[model samples]
Target: MIDLHLIGIGTGNPDHLTGEARRAITQADLILVPHKPGKSDLADLRTRIIAEVCDDALIALFDMPVRDDTLPYLTRVDAWHDEIARIWAATMAAHPEAQKIALLVWGDPSLYDSTLRIAARLDPAPRLHVVAGITSIQALTAAHAIPLNTLNAPVTISTGRRLRDHGWPDGCETLVVMLDADCTFQSLDGDGFDIWWGAYLGMPEQILEAGRLSDASVRIIARRAEARAAHGWIMDTYLLRRRA
Candidate 1:
């Protein structure tokens, strides 16, 4: 039986790893790092994180399966996840002696990540353990030096696709957007809102911009594009709130 640990490594920062994350990494028999095409930096970061906390660690570097965009969104994601599960099982089979396996997730697994869901698909399901880490939202807020919410007001976390399709969620003046490749803020009127945006948070390549949404959108778009070109990939998030 495999004891699978879903460890959150935090938003691309080795120092963001908690003591529990370190313990999990050190105890793991094998750690899996999936490298996507044109995104080698992502896999390299995971490898570096493992090396930082564990000596002579057993790591499996595998190519990530590409999602079929031609299929509908939900179906595409479901099938893609299934393919990942198959790969994980095969990888484990190759390392029969490794009963304690770990996956280094980006940010907290409970927040907008699919590692847990994919893990669940393993045959004869393995025992699961979770190690929480700092999230991108926290990184963004800390980078901007702003409170997540004003007073007792609530904050809503959403994806860029949702924000673009549905506009702002009802009853939420403060919205944090993730997984947006295109700057969807341009779709918003942005009259009374302020935006705090950060890219590659907690890393040396980190960039932060905060101002009225109307004024900041242009700068954000330009900078985000330039950074993406420079690094070949970017993970960013933004918090938008109506100015009180």
Candidate 2:
């Protein structure tokens, strides 16, 4: 069986890598790196991190398949994952001598990433090993210097689409949203909620804005657009809480 190591490299910083993640990378026979065509910065960052932390492994870089945005959202993502799986299989097939393969996952694989799902599609599925890294949620909380929850209250993690599609969730006063292409907070009408929003968390170009949603929503949207244009790619997450 192939040995698969899903190592979380943390957010965007090379130093965010844990000792365990470093060991996993160095121990692997081969490490597969995905190269997103238009998002070359992200690809470069991942490659740099691997280079800094893993000195002994053979690194194989492969082009990432573009997800077809024309198809309906879910269907499009499904097709994209299929394409990625095919590429991954081919890559591994070419390197049969690689008994242990490592994938440097951004943040934890257990989060919103689909690397785990794609791994399942392998013909002879590898024995999976996971080393958890700092998630965006952790980075957000740490950057904001605030606890994720208040007085034993619940915190719900969601996506921007969910927030727009289904207003607010029931029974949860605190919400953390990720994978938001649009500023969905504007859709929420920005009432009494306080927001702690951050862009490029844990990176050198990190930007943060926090205040009443009503006060900060517009600025966050404008700043996010400017930064995305400047960097060509942006990954951001925010926390919203209805003041208790």
Candidate 3:
């Protein structure tokens, strides 16, 4: 059985790696990295992490398959996960002697990441171990120098899809949004709201914007578009708070 380690590397920054994450990488018999065609930089970042932390470790690379968009949402995701699991299995099979494998995850694996769910589908599933690292929300709040919660008020954490489908969550003074590809904040009324946004957090190319929602919404949308175009990919998260 494989001893799988899902180590959170925290937004592609070396400083974000913990001692536990370093140990997991060094101790692993194999490290698998996923590559996307146009997003080679992401794969490069993981490679760089390995080079810096564990240069002597054996590395394997696999191409990540794109999800089929034609199917219904949940169905599409389930099928995609199955495909990823298959790819993972095939990769692991190639190194039959390697009993310990590690995959570096961006941010904490438990938050807005599907790695854990995909691992569950592995046949003769590996023994799972998770090493937590700083989440994008933590990076966002830290970059903005703001408190995530306001004086005992509850904070609602959600994805951009939910923010678009359900509008602002009820009973929460602060909302932290993640995995927002569409800049969903533009869909909401911007009055009396403050937004703290960050893109490519913890990386050298990191960008941050914050101000009244009314003032920052359009700028964030334009900036995000330009950045995505330039880099061919982008990962961003933000915090929105309603004025008292």
lDDT of 3 by residue, 161-212 (tens): 9999988887778999998898899887788799999999999999999999
- Strongest candidate by lDDT: 3
Give model 2's clash tally.
0
Task: List per-prediction Cα lDDT, in the order shown.
Answer: 0.93, 0.90, 0.94
lDDT of 1 by residue, 1-244 (tens): 8999999988988899999999999999999889999999899999999999997999998889999999999999999999999999999999999999999999999999999999999997999999998999999998888899988888899999998899889888899999999799999877778999999999989999989998999999999999999999999999999877
TM-score quality measure for candidate 1: 0.98
Pairs in steric clash, model 1: none
Shift of residue 8 alpha carbon in model 3, Å: 0.4
Better of 2 and 3 by lDDT: 3
Off by over 4 Å in 2: none
lDDT of 1 at 118: 95
Model 1 deviation from the true structure expressed as Cα RMSD, one decimal place: 0.8
* Model 3 residue 116 lDDT score: 100
lDDT per residue for candidate 2 within 95-176, as digits (tens), equals 9999999999998999999999998888888999999999999999999999999997888999999999998898879999
List of clashing residue pairs for candidate 3: none
